[model samples]
Structures are given as structure tokens and as C-alpha cells.
Target: MNFCLPYSATRRVLAAALACAVTLPVAAAFAAQAPAPATLRLDYLHTGNASTEQYAIERVVIEPLPWPGNMARTVDDTDRGVNKVEVVDKASGKLLYSRGFSTVFNEWRSTAEAEKVNRGFEESVRFPKPDHAVTVRILKRDENNAFTLAWSTELDPDAPDVVRKQEPSALRPIPIRVSGPSPDKVDLLILGDGYTAGEMKKFEATARRMADQLFSVSPFRERAGDFNVWALAAPTPESGVSRPSTGVHHASRLGTRYDIFGSERYVLATDNRALRELAQNAPYEFIEIIVNNDTYGGGGIFGQFSTAAANSDWAKYLFIHEFGHHFAGLADEYYTSPAVYQPSGARVEPWEPNATALRDPANVKWKKFVAAGTALPTPWPKAEFEAYSRDIQQQRVALRKAQRPESEMSALFKRELAHEEELFSRAPNRHAVGAFEGANYEATGYYRPQLQCMMFDRSEQFCTVCQDAISTIIDLYSRPAPH
Candidate 1:
């Protein structure tokens, strides 16, 4: 874990510790001057039905890479996720390390299937290894929107049961962008799935292209220097991932595929263990999975991972839009699209930084950005928008029902975006930060920050509120907290 050793000594020690021939570009002045602790991961099982949930310890792992986070900013104050993990000193109950993240299990709980079935999901939380035992607590928001303790367990990084060593990975991380030491930069790993050895070059090129696409946006473009991007992939036996809806299935390294939760375009890797195992080889705080397919599909979960179809015509938009969810827990601002989650009868304020229930219009969550005279429930072309969206939705369903070409779907999306842009442009509050009524998959209660955003539609940039939310996380990983 010590990075203060001489260049030669550090190289030898790091090489020995990794159990692999691959070397990171960390033997430099910053590393030689600082000390970074080893990374510790707590793998656990999150299981339950719609009404009940439980957590159990699976195993602890000491990852080969050091902790890729700002040592001074170990506590997450953003409060952006449905769940939060806190590492506390067992003896003194002092908080050590904490982070906010969402799990697939929580997402599944909202599905109608969860009412009749109980399921389990593998989940993991990583932190800098502490010197002593710590009580890891998982907190979930109650009806009142406060984090209440859900589960707790004691763990010692030095315990004999801890996994201290791992078999070397056949895959090596390719440096797409090297800003600085990982501790001082947001380490983003671009992982590829469903890519064969013959398509390795294609995967790397796609990864680079996606990384470039991500940084072309507002917040990322302005703060490009505060990030380090790495690419890694375990070559699959064949190309393209499983898409059950279309009856296309292929073996993939990460087990990521399309048609998750019965949504045809929704893609996700339910294998958390596989994802963490491959990702542990690289220095990463956030992950963006790029599946080798031309289908327009991708998905994201807060503080966990995002995915995009690397060869899709809307690849750039998917790469950044899904990252909005995975990177900063930005909620989907659009409501017309069909989603897997069942409609909630209650109107509780969402934990996402973007969307809200708007119970108190005078004091909306993003109130500061609201103009002096702007209306609370900012009026837009709602009726027209919804009508247009319904027609487009029908067309979308027909395209999928008939198994139409992807190009046709892409063309439909282009038209939809064009119609939306023209409609919103004529609205009075198109650029206002007032609450636009319609977000989080609900057309009634939830509201968004602006008339349009990446989370809302196929837009190129995030709204002002979303950009601010993203900047908060960027600062959390890239620099020390203000004293």
C-alpha cells in the first residue's frame, strides 16, 4: 500500500503486489510523495421481496489496486442514492469511509414480479482499508426521506478470512486518458463485454470514442483535467451480447446482455461478482460498460455502473446519458417512455438530484436556480408533447413488435428529438430553471429542473441543475473537501 518508496523499490513492490505483469503509471513524483492505502471490498448478498430486504456477508477482498479516491473526502455528503454505506470504527463508532450507491436489488423491488417472488443480488462496497475493525452499515431511506439503518456487520481487513490474493487477470487496463494520480482524479474504467479477441482493436477504439464522447459534454468538458480514464475487457468467444427479445444470445465475459427486466432495450449485468472481479484489476471509482453491439440499448445505476451499446447510431448520447444515472444518480426526466418499474401510488420525493415530487412549490429542491418571477410548476407544451409522445411510443412499439431494422428505430428517435426541440423552443420557459411537471417515469407528481435535458430526451447536454449535480461528484472524487 505504501507509495512513498524509491522509484525502483515502488516498481518492484507494486509488481509483486498486483500478481500480474501489468504496471500502472504511478511511479512518479505524486506517488513518491504520498501514501495511499490498499483497496478493501466487501461483497455481500442483498436479498428480499417487494416488502422485505436483508443483507448477508459473503466475503471480503483486498483488491490488487490501491484505493482510487480522494483520501480527504472519504465521507459522501451528496446523499444522492437510495442506499448509503458507512464504514465506522467498531470501538469508537467514528465514521471512517462512506459512499452512496444504488443496487439492482432495490430497482427490482419496484417490479410487479417482486410481489410474488423473492430474489437475491450480489453487491459490493469498496473503501480504503483501515487499520482496525469497522462496522459497515447499510442505510436506506424511509418514507420520510431520511436514511435509516437497514443492515450492519463488522469486518476486519486483516482478518484471516479476507481474500488477500487473486489470480492474475489475463486482461490489462489500457490507459485512455492519464490526468494524474488516481487519488487526485476521478478514475473511470471503460469495460467492454461481448467482444471477441478478433474485435479487441474495435473494443479499444470504441472505448476511446466513448470516453471522448463523455468528455464532450458540459461538466465533463470543463473539468476534463480532473479525470483519468482506463479501458479493459476480457475477450469473449464470440461477438455481441445476449438479447433474448430478439432471440440473439452469445457468451459474454461480464454476463451483460439486453432485455433486462423484460424491457427489450434495457441492458444490465446482473453478475455483480463478475463485474467487481474484472474491475478490481484496474484503478476505478466509476465504471462505464461498453457492450459490442449495434442495438440501441444501455442502462445505469447510481454509483454502480453504466452501460452503452458501443456500435449504436446513438452511441454518443447513450454513453453520456446513461453515465448521468451511473455517475451522479441523475433521474430520468422524461415520463412518456415505457419503463419496467411499476407506477407508485404514493408521491414521495425521489433521492435523485434532478427529479422531485414538488409537494412544496415555494421551496423546490433546485430552488436557488429558479428565477425571481418564474412559475413554480413551470408550464410547457405538455398536452402537445404528450400527444406527440404517445404517437411516437406507438410507432416504437410497432417497430419492435415487427422486429424492424435498427435504422428505422434510430430514424424515429431523430424525428422525436426534432419534434421535442421545436416544441420546447417555442415554450415560454424553455431555459428557465423552474420545475417542469413530468419526470421519474411519472407524468403527474414528479418534476424536472428544466424543459429539456439529457436525462429527459436525446439531448446533447445536461441541464443547468444536472450539470451542477455532476460537478459536485466530480469535486468529491478529484479534490479534498474544503476546510
Candidate 2:
């Protein structure tokens, strides 16, 4: 007290002590915070009909967030926006949770453009944690009103069974094969097309019937419990029962065109924006386009969109068969059918599972299925083959005569059901010659593997080759439900 320090020294000592105390607390706080959990990434690949749109997810992973008691799972749809996701507990076989989200972009014509849009969308998604076992689905939109599911998850990380990415060249290309709700639980979304509010109910019924037929088949029957069907309804004004047309025309490939629907040319070629917008709401494995018309026309390109001419007598069968092509990469077996191909390339090995020019028979995709006694270059019966060919020539002549612009003959052909029926009946052996009236290829040189199949004709039966292909696709999607 007698020798007290100066005021400046006293102030300096107090300041140093205060600084030390502050630093210690700050260090403790930093130590208490934990680092973010690692992320689990998932990618989606789609395989459907060729006539429909197709897409794939390139970059994105689903990571789990740490949460107790399986109450809720957090998902990070990395970089790509999360359109929709559904969570199902495999053990419980019950839907635990589901959510639908939206995005700014509507559609992209090219995959590159889609990826860019997805990248921007992905930046906006934030997750609370990164370590959880839950299934997530992602979709991207495109033209033809098509959307592709890019990813999914297996709910229990501890379970040995899980979904895997398929090789690009794998023979079967579809994501899921079962027809009913899955035991392991699944989330499905049915992409929509030109249908109105009234048509939506019919569309759903049609889809349900198609799904039921699909599971009733062999491989699907085996694995019926591990699947689900969800509809993502996308409707348009052009998606109704009928439309104005300039009468049906006969082409050597895709026989008879009814140019009445304004949607035909534009729907398949343009409409990507609408597709993407619809995809932003649900988790789906496949995107099915339900056209509003009831005409007997449908098209499917492998790993692409599957479409059915709506409201027809054969809608259910047509749906399943076309879906086989879109989902399973199955090849058309009837080669003599009318088609859109120009036939320019050298007679090389075809990419389809059923057709081949025998460019290299030794390594055919379906070589295993070829019967031992089956002859290579199977001989066509001369009498029946010639009769069918003659009928085609006559039909061509009739079609040309009726095609005169603005003539009564054209009008007569357009309204004459009897004439059309008579013409179709002439080619009773068309199936035998493998020359169907409405396929996409020339009649003589090409031959489809099966004599009677839905792909070959509107016949209800699917050939063994097609059935096998469907089975393989189902296996790829999930393990078949127990018998």
C-alpha cells in the first residue's frame, strides 16, 4: 500500500488477465462443436420404351443424418434438387414419411442442359445431418413429358441387401419389375401426359390394371412384394378423348396415321418443359405418359418413355407390352411390320434382344434362348408368305388411291370400317411372315423372332423372349417378392 504501483501498470495487468479468461472459454466452445457427418451418394438410371423420353442421374449422393430411434431420416439429394422422396420401413412395410418439393426450371431438351439445371437446384438443398438409412428418389424432366428418377435408398444401412447401380451395357435395363406393393417397401410415381381432370380417373384405372398384369407374369410374380406404384399426374388440353385429324394414312412401317391429334408431332418432340415441372413433385422409378386418345397406337423405345394410346379396348395389354420395351430393353420380334426405319446401314448385328441379321450369330444377345433345332435364317413358307405380300401390295394401292388430296375416295376410306377390316383380314399370315402392318421396319428382309406377340401385333400374348427380358428387368429393379 505504501509503495503502490502507477496507474498505467495497474491497468495493463488487469487487461492481460481479462484476455486470458476470454481465450479459454472460446477454445472450449470450439472443442464442443462436432464436424458434419459423411454423405452417402446415390445415382439413378432409367430404362423404358424408346418412343418415350429417357434420362439418367450423373452426379449426386444420398447421405444419412444421425438420428435416434428410426423416427426420421434426413436426406441430402446432393447438388440436384430433390423433387420428391418417400420413406418406407422394410420391416414394417408401411410408409413412414413422404415429401414433395418444387424447382424453378420446367424442362431440358438435352441431358447436358438438364445437368446444369440440376446443379443449380442442388445448391439450394440443406440437410440437418448426414448419417441416416432412408430411401430417397430424384426426378428430372424432359420432352415427351418424360421425367427420370435419378436416385433411391435402402432404409436400413445395417441390412446386407441394398440397391446397386447397373452396368450401362447390361442386357436388361429397367429399374423395378414387381407389379404390387413391395415387402421391402417402394415409392413409385406415374408421369402424366395429355389428360384432363375427368380423364385422370380412367388413366389411373388403366395404370393399375397394367401393373396388375405385369406382376401376374412369372418373374414379377416371384417378386411381387417389393414394389409400389405412384402416379404423378400431368395433364394437358391435347390430352383428351378425341381430336381433329386429316384421316389415317398408310405407311410401309407405322401403318395408318390419324393426323387429327395436334399432339402427335409436338408431344413427343417438344414438351420437355412440362415434363420437368411435373417431375418436381414425387419420387418415381418410371415415368408413364398416358395419352388421352383411345386409338390403337403405342410406342416404346428401350430406356426411354413408355406411352399408350389411351381409352382403347386393348389399353391394358398395350401398356404392359410397350412398357416392356421402355423398361426392359426388349426387342420387337415381328420384323415384317411397317416401321419408320430407312434401312441405310450394312446388314449388321442389331442392338435389340430379339432381332439379328446374323452379322455375328456366335455372340448374339439371346443366343442362349435359341432352340437347338431352330434353323438359322428360318425359311418362310412360300405360299403363305406370297399371299401376305400380295395383300400388302393391294393395301398400298388402295391407300394411295384414298390418299388423293381432298377427294371422296379419301373420305370414303377414312370413314369405312368395313374396308379397313377387310384389308387387315387379307394378311392373316402376316404374323407368320413376320410382316406386321404397323411396325417401323421394311417387311421382307427383317424378321421378328416371335410369330405372335404384343410387340409384333396387338395380340395379348408376349413371346418367351419378351417375357424373359421382362423378368431380367424386374430382377434389376428389386429382388422378386417371395413366391
Candidate 3:
């Protein structure tokens, strides 16, 4: 296994090394003029109930790695999230960095609990290190979906209170797929949760397998070369994550578990500190935590992280479907599945690319993609589909209440998809790109693009609109935006 490099390659490397050595003084002079940019993270607390919200600065830190994003594409104009972060020069008022991202707290606020009690969440936003002091502003969309400043804070990188150093960690990331330099590629960190020391190999294998499945789908398949996949995991003492409903508990490294917000199928990592500490050890812009569990559960937050049950029967679907939310801010297109989030009386047009309010069908958000003859609020066996889905939902509830085997749940999903396939295959607008009612966990009001999609069901392939949305994010992370 001790293979040496080819003679010519070795000579070229040595020559390059010698060249660096000879230009040390010149290099040092240039470095002094313009040092490489570090990654600066602003950690904060987002606290409030459903109606009122507040933001408080916690601390600022220099992440372990340099920012792994294209400096050329610092401004995010895609307008996708419920909130947007803007970093600007304080004195000159020059916008330097900006990005739109949603939060777990935003999702929580939609739930019934937010009506009575207030809660806080630890959140962080990262940007390229600025040379001098800068102003960081958090903007939220008003009722009309316009960005309005919610909170603003001044930050000085040289401030003595800023955390400039971190203790070295034993956690190292394994390179799953290195396409090119970190700056040019979208760094996707596949984090493993609830894995023991003995399951390290399994974690890597699952990460690779899921990564392969990711690239097998459209958009990601075509843009596979634009991504670099990195796998990282801190070992746990137990074999699986906690399932509070099932009375199963394990001290996982990432604090990932099911039963989030009282939904047994929902999974998320609550320990943002532990997650950030481990994730900083690797170069990553997006993260997908692959939890070692078979039960059907996953969750995603835009600009944050996503989790998938790596051992589930529908792992591929879970990974990509949840990623659709975490990566591109795609709304949940399926409504048959019950959710904890309560619906608002108002259905303002969603900022997400996939979901729309269809306030005006002729001026639909994705109207350009709509084909001729395709009706707005397109018709698609709605009554029949809802009736069938309701029956299947009751079966689903029975299975879960009976504490049925995981295989039984998987089998039920397979049956449901099969039924949907048969039902939609004959519909006139089955494959059309038009507004389809019944999305965003509501039977009406909200509409999704196309009749069927991975977001809409367990089926494969993102709808045309979803594919475009995902591509926009990939470009935002990996390439410069159009001038």
C-alpha cells in the first residue's frame, strides 16, 4: 500500500514547494496587505410567542474554518426566507453580505403552544469576516412579504469580547466527495446522530449511500460536480436516537431525536451549541444530519440543517424531501399528513418558490413556467384524492397508535403511493405545471406547483418549479449571481 507518486508528479510538487520557499518574503508582504478572510458567526437568541418576537445578541465567534462560499455572490437577492440577514459597513452603509433563511423558531411560532407561552431559540448567522466594524441587521417579511428591519447590532471583529479561538476538537470530517476547492463547491456536511463508536463505518457507508441517492435525482444529479460532501460524527454511547413517545432514550451527540413539537415523525437536533462546535471542525455551508434510526422521521429548517433517518425504508425520499425545505426553503406540498403548525386566518402569498397563495391566478408567482391551456387552480381529482387520503390517514393513525412495527408503517406508505399513482395517472393535468390546491398543510387556500411531486408524496423527482428553486440555491452557494 506504500505507493510512491510518479517521478514527474513528485518533481512538480517539489518544484512548487521550492518556489513557495523562495518567495516567502514576497508572499508575507502581500499577506500583510490583504489577509485571507475568516468566517465570522453571530450567535443570538430569537425569543417570543406567536404574535410578538424579539432578538438578543448572545456572542460573536470566529469559526474554525474560513467561509466556504463564493465571495463574489455575497448578496442574496433570491428572496426566499421569512427573515433575511444583512451585513454592512457601519460608516459608509455599504451592503457587504446578505442571505435569507428561515428558522426553527419561525416554525414553532405557527404551533398552538406559541399562542400562550413564549420560548427562545439559539440561532446563528455567518458571513465573511469584515475588516472593520460592521452593522448586522435582521429583516423580517411584513404581511405583504416585504423585508423590514427587525433587529440591528454593531459588531467589531477586533473586540476583546469576541471569541477568536476555539479548543481543538478530536472530531474530524471524512471527505465523502471532493469535487474541487472549498470556495468553488457547495460543501454539504453529512452529520451522523445516535451513532456509537462501533458504528462509525456504518455512518460513513450510509452517508455515501445517501449522497449517491441524492445525485441520482434531477438537478442534483446534473449538478453533482458542483458539490463536495463531507461526513462527520461524534460517537454516542447508544445505538439509536431518543423516541420520547416510545419511551426510548439515548444521549446522542447532536441531541437529535423524534417527537419534536409533539409530532412523533418529526426529528431535529435541539443542541445548536454542540452542533456548531462539531460542525465548525469541517468546511460546510449546508448540513444534513443522518440519524441512525429506522422509524419514519425527519425535519429541516432553511439556512440551518436537515435530518434524515438513514436506516428508514424511505431514506432517499426523506433525505431529499426534507432537504427541499432546508436547502431551498420549499414549503411542504403535502396536506394529508397532519402537522403541529396551526393555520393562520390569512393566506398571504408565501415567499417560498414552490408554494403560492394564488391570490391572482393570471399573475401567479410561477406563471412563466405555467403551460398554455393549464388552468390556474388546476383541477386534479381533489375530492377523490382527499377521500382516499383520509381513509389512509386513519389507517396510519391506527398503526402508530398500536405501536406497529416500522415495516408496517413503511408498507402503509408504499400502499399510499401506489394508490396515488393509480389515481393521478388518469387525471388530465397530472403532469402539468399549474397551481394545485391542497398544500402547506391545508386542504384549501395554499397551492403547489404541479399535481404530484416528492414534496407532495413519497414519489420521486422534484416538480419543475421545485427543481428551479433548488438550482437557484446551488448557484447562490457555488457560483456568482448574474449582474
Candidate 4:
């Protein structure tokens, strides 16, 4: 049986270094004289649609925890995400920090509803509280896939109106793996929802099990010590989250539920404020919400959060696959599923690491990893795979229409995966790392790094290019300051 440590449980890993120390030699002196900077978070509303968009400032707050990221690595050079946030010094206009991220709003804009009605989503971005005032600029990609300023605001962390006090923390975080200070590691927080007070043990157990599963996978497996895993969840009144498709509705701790955007398997929390309020209590750079239901559903947003049904049969696969999106800005490589997004007629380059528009075959984004003689437009058994997938999808729709048991859905997925593995195993260039067509919810034009990957399917490992991409982010967070 799994159990959560009580609030009295002492933290197992203490901070080995301070947040302000940019290098090793200065760490001791800095630690002795300077206090770690507080965390400043900017809350705003993103309202828009497919063609037009607007942003509005909601508020600013100082979180309970100090900044969790490395001071030396303040700028994100990894060309990823649909949007980027840049914080600059107000006086000299020097860029202080920046990171790329995707939003629920961006995903919603791709769907059919965006053509008619406008929607709004609350968002927040955090940085180390600066000593002086700073200007925050949010950049969005234009039609040509270049970033342009969407919104900009001047922020004063010491302003009288900035929210500095928070409700007393009702829940404490459990340290699953604490390698070192949060500033020196990728601080990942696993939040549990739909877990009742009596099932707190289950949440803790699942969190620990998932952490082990994550570390057992490649890249993560090889660099386990570069991470610090923390678990936090508040007790819910029910044992499972809301599933409106089945006429079920139970309020969960983090407002997480299935059937996002009317897709049965899509799970995510729409309440960013609720999520951030609880997450701010813990030191976290990434979040993966573990829903306590036994449903086959999950969702992820780049640099924001990921979700997985913790008790699902395919929990391990869902855990790692969704994390790929949240952790490394990896695009989904599979295209067979009926996603909510509408198809695009024009080919625009995606900013994700794995998937590409392949508009210029000669100058592929991942050309460095491509081997000689490997075709730019790599061929695969597309017709057969799609045919098989269509049939399976039909059966899947039928099963769901009948309101079948979760076990039935799980079994069907197993058979589907088995079929795919069998087909790919016999194909030519099955293991090649060339661009394979059919990705990012499209059947053509877009490409993936390899024939098989966790992003592509329910495989247990990331592709070589994916491994490198993940390593780059890990380096951004975990690499120590210059000697």
C-alpha cells in the first residue's frame, strides 16, 4: 500500500547551494551574505481566436518559494514553443530572463470553435524576483514562424499592490527524489487530484512509482541525479475526477477532469490559478498532475503542466509521453486519432523539437542527425498503417458509444499497439532517424525524427534526436555554473 508522509515528516534533501550564487567559487560567499531572491509571478488573461488575439494583465504575485531555476541560465536559446516570455531591466533594457512555452489558448485556436466565438484563459509566468524594476514582454509567433511581441508590461516586485501573502499552506510536498538544491536540478512537481483523504497513501505510492518509471526510461534514466522530484496533493471529497462524458462529475483538488475540449481521453486543468496557488508552495520548474481516476486520459502544455490518469492501465506510457510535451516541447508524432483541432491548408513550420513542416527538405531542422543516403522524405507503410488505424478507430468509437468499461478501452489500446509494433518491425528503415511523414495531427507534410518513439507511439524510449533535445533542457537547468 502507498502512503503519504505526514506533515511532520522532515525534508530528506536540504539545499546544497543558494539561489543567487551564479558560480561555485562565489556560492559560499553569496550564500553567507545574500538571501535567495523571491519568486515573482505575473498573472494575465489571454483572450483571442485563430486570426486575432489579445492579452490583459490580471495581477502580479510573489510566490511562497524562492526561484527554483539556475541564476546563470536565465535565457532560453532553445528555439521551441509557440510563445516566449522575456523579462528585461527597465533602466538599461538588458534582457534578464526568458523562456518559451505554449498555452491552452494556442491549442484552442486550432480547433473549430475558435472560428466563431472568443475564449479566455488565465496564465502566469514566474522569474526570480529582481532587485530593480523589470519589463515583461510576451512574444508570439507570426505567420512566418517568427516571434513578435504580443504583450508587454512593466513590473515592480516591490510594488504596494503585488500580492505578497498567501493562504497558509494546507498541504506539504513529499520529496520523492532530492539530488541537490532546486536551483541546481530540474525541479519536477507531481500533483495528485481526485484523491480522497483516505487515499493519500495511494497518491504518494503512485507518485513514487511513476518517478521510478520515469527514471527507468532513457535520457531520464541516464540522468536521474539531475532531477529533484516533489509530490503534493490535497484530499478530495471523491475518489475519481469528473468525467462528463459518462455523466459523472466529482470536484477534484486541482480542478482536473477528463473530456477536455469534448475529447473523452483529453485531461487537463483549466484552472491555472488553482494550480499555481498550490504549486507555488513547492519548488517546481515542471508539473505533471496525476489524476486519481482509472480512466485512459491525459494532456500536456509545453513548459506548463502535464496530466495522466494515475490508476489507468497505461499509466506508465501516459506519464512519460505527456511529460515529453511539457518537459521538452516535443510535438505529437501520431496522426491517426481524431483530435479536436481543424486541419490547416497551408504549411507553417512548427517550433516543436520533434515534428517539422518539412517545407524545405534540403535544410531539414534536424539535418545534423540525418545520415547519408537516408531519404529526406522517408517512406513508411503509410497506407497499411492508416487502414489498420481507421478500422481500430471505428471500433474504438463503437466501444465508447456503448459506454464500455475502462478495461475494454485498455485492452483495445494494447491490441492497437501490438498491431503497430508488428507492422513497424518488418518495415524497411524501421529504426532509421530520418524524417517520417504524418505527424502533428496531420497525415502529410509534417515529419517526425524516427520511425518509432514514445512521442510517436506507446514505445518505452525517446528517439535519439529527442534524447538530445531533452538533454539540452536538462543542461539548461542542471549544468553547474562555470568553474
Using TM-score as the measure, the top candidate is 1
Candidate 4: the clashing residue pairs are 2-201, 3-201
For model 4, residues 1-483, the per-residue Cα lDDT tens digits are 222222221222112232111222212222222345778999999998888889898989998666777888999999789999999999999999999999999999988889999999999999988889999999999889899999999888889999998767667677788776667788899999998999999899999999999999989988898988889898989898999999999986577888888899999998899999988767789999999888888999999999999999999999999999999999899999899998888878888888888888888888998988999899889899999999989999999999989899889989989999999999898988788999998999889989999998888889988999998889988854332
How accurate locally, in lDDT, is each candidate?
0.88, 0.42, 0.87, 0.85
Candidate 4: C-alpha lDDT: 0.85
Which residue segments of model 1 deviate by more than 4 Å? 1-20, 24-30, 480-483
Task: Output the TM-score of candidate 4.
Answer: 0.92
Candidate 1 lDDT tens digits, 1-483: 323322232534553444334554533212532557788999999999999998999999998777778888999999889999999999998999889999899999999899999999999999999999999999998998799999999898889999998997777788888887677888999999999889999999999999898888998998998888989999899888999888898887778999888999899987899999999878899999999998999999998999999999999999999999999999999899999999879999988989999989999998989989998888899999999999999999999999999999999999999999999889999898998899999999899999989999998989999999999999999863232
User: Which one wins on lDDT?
Assistant: 1
TM-scores, all candidates, are 0.95, 0.50, 0.92, 0.92
The list of candidate 3 runs beyond 4 A from truth reads 1-35, 480-483
Please give the range of 10 consecutive residues that has the lowest summed lDDT in model 2.
63-72
Task: Name the lDDT of candidate 3.
Answer: 0.87
Candidate order by lDDT, decreasing, is 1, 3, 4, 2
